[model samples]
Target: MKIVSEKLAQDQFTQLKLKNLKTILAESIAQADRGELHNINDVFASLTKDKHEDISNSNI
Candidate 1:
């Protein structure tokens, strides 16, 4: 039981950390957009996102 509880706790912590990271990334992008910051990594991340849409699909 102790091992299971530890695993659950670790998973929860990992989720929270990922959520925080996404929030920070969004804030960094917003700040960069406003000209309040300059970080190439953030800029690159924003630009390199997968934007491929189903534009070729006839269903649309």
Candidate 2:
């Protein structure tokens, strides 16, 4: 995921919308701490699937 992290660092969407990696990681950790951990792995796997069908679906 090094390439993905590099892409995110240079991504215009991330720059305009979010500030930096620390901010994003903090928010994600907070959400995960709030009882949102159960499906995190499964959800991530589903979303990052080759076809990425989960992203097109609202269930994610």
lDDT of 2 by residue, 1-60 (tens): 999988987797657535544555566677678866566564445225624663467565
- Each candidate structure's TM-score, on Cα atoms with residue i matched to residue i, is 0.62, 0.30
The segments of candidate 1 whose C-alpha lies over 4 angstroms from its true place after superposition are 40-60
lDDT for model 1 comes to 0.69
Runs with alpha carbons beyond 4 Å of true place in candidate 2: 1-19, 37-60
Query: Cα miss at 41, model 2 (Å)?
Result: 6.8
Model 1 quality (TM-score): 0.62
Worst 10 residues of 1 by lDDT: 47-56
True-structure lDDT of candidate 2: 0.59
